[model samples]
Target: MPRLNETDRCRAVGMIEAGVRHTDVAIQFGVHRNTVDALCRRYQQFGTTRDRPRSGRPRITSNRQDTYIRVVHLRERLRTATLTARNIPGLRRISPRTVRNRLRERGIRPRRPAIRPVLQQRHRVARFA
Candidate 1:
C-alpha cells in the first residue's frame, strides 16, 4: 500500500490530538489503526512526520570509472566482456559479469562479430569472371 503524504499525516495527527480514537481516525482515513497510532507517536516524539534519511551499501565503482569503462568499450567494440574487464585498471578484482553490468548501465551490449569464410584472390577473380 502507498504511504500517506505530509498533509494527510498532519491531518491525522490533528484529529488524534482533538481526542479522536485511533481506530476512528484510521477508519476515517482508510488506513490501518497501527499507521495512525505510529504517526501520532512519531509526531509526539519527533514533532514532524517527515521520513528520515536512509542508508544503504555504497557503490563499488565511481562515475569516473564507469565513464572510463564506457570509453574503452567504445574504442574496442569487438572486445569480449572478460577481456574488457581484464584490460580495465582497478577492475581486476571484479568479474566479467560486473563489467557487463556496468556497460549495460551505459546502454552498451556485447555481441560476437559477424563470421564469414576468407575469400582468396582466385575466388574473387572467378566471381568477377
Candidate 2:
C-alpha cells in the first residue's frame, strides 16, 4: 500500500487537533487506529507529520552509469546482458540480472540469439541440387 500524502497527513492532524478521537480519525480515514496513533505521536514528537529521511543502502550506479549501460546495449544489440555486464568498465561487480533490470528500466531488452542447426557440406549440396 502507498504511504499517505502530505494533504492526508495534514487533514488527519487537523482532525486530531480539533478534538477528534484517534479511533474516530482512523475510521474516518479508513486506516488502522495504530496508524492514527503513530501519526499523532510523530506530530507530537517531531512537530511535523511529514516523512523523515529513511536510511538504506545507497545506489551503486549513478545516472551516468545507467546511461553508459543504455548506450552500450544500443551499440551492441546482439550482446547478452551477461556479456555486457562482464565487458562494461566499472560495472564488472554487478550481476547480469541487475544489468538486465537496469536495461529494462530504460526499455532495452537483451535477447538471446536464435539457435539454428549446422548444415554439413553434403546437406548443403543436396539442397542446392
Candidate 3:
C-alpha cells in the first residue's frame, strides 16, 4: 500500500477525533482501514504524527567523502574515474563505477582528454601558404 505523508496522516487523525469512523476516514482518504488505526495508535504513542526513521542501505561513502571526490576531480579535470577512485584514501575499497556515478550526480561527465597532433612552425607556415 502507498504511504501517507505527515499532512494526510494528521488530517485522518483529526477526522477520527471529530467522531468519524475509521472505515469512513479510510474510504475518504483512499487508505486502508488498518492504516487509519495505526496512525491513531501512532499519535497516541507519540504526540506528533511524524514518521519514524526508516533503516535502508547505508551509503558506500559519506557526504564528506563525496565532497572530497568532487574536489579531487575539480582540481584535476583530466583525471579518470579509476585513477581518482584509487588515489582517494577514503575511497580505497569503493569501485571506480561509484566514483563515476558520484561525478555524474555533480553534473561532471567522464570524457577523454583532447589529443592534438604536434605541428612545427614550418608546418603551420606551409599549411597557411
Candidate 4:
C-alpha cells in the first residue's frame, strides 16, 4: 500500500490533536495505534505532517530521477518518463521512481558505448602467387 501523503497525515494529526482517541484514529486511517502515536510524535518534531521511517523495499531510482522528476514536473512528462508509447492513456499509474528503475533494468541508459566496424579488403587486394 502507498504511504499517506502530507494532507492526509495533517488530517490525521488534526483529528488526534482534537482529542480523538488513538484507537479511533487507527480505525479511521486503517493503521495501528502505534502508527497514530508515531504520526503525532513526528508532527511534533517536524512541525509538519510526516510519517516515520517505513520499513520496506528501498526506492530503486537514484537521485538523478528525483531531479528529473522535478525538472519534468508535468503530468504528461511524468507519465512518459520511461519513454514508452502506450495506447491506453489511463491504464496504470507508476511512480517516477518506478520508471527510472525500469529504465535501469533494461540497460537503457543515457550514455552508450562507441563502436565502429573495420572494413576488410579481399577482392581488391587478392594475393596471387
Highest lDDT against the true fold, candidate: 3
Error of 1 at 72 (Å): 7.3
What is candidate 1's TM-score against the reference?
0.52
lDDT by residue (tens digit), candidate 4, 9-125: 888899988999989988887877887788888888889775547799975445654444434434343345434322213435455446555555555442222466766776458
List of clashing residue pairs for candidate 4: none
Whole-model Cα lDDT per candidate?
0.82, 0.84, 0.86, 0.62
Q: Pick the candidate with the highest TM-score.
A: 2
For residues 11-105, write the lDDT of model 1, one tens digit per residue: 98888889999999899888899998889888889999897778987777778778877888899898877886677677446667877888998
User: What lDDT tens digits, residue by residue, belong to model 3 across residues 2-113?
Assistant: 7888889889999999999999999998889999998899999898799899899777988887998899889888888888777777624787888888999999976555
What TM-score does candidate 4 get on C-alpha atoms?
0.42
Model 2 worst lDDT window (10 residues):
120-129
Displacement of residue 98 (Cα, Å) in model 2 is 1.4
lDDT of 4: 0.62
Candidate 1 at 47: error in angstroms?
0.7
TM-score on alpha carbons, each prediction: 0.52, 0.73, 0.66, 0.42
Off by over 4 Å in 4: 51-129
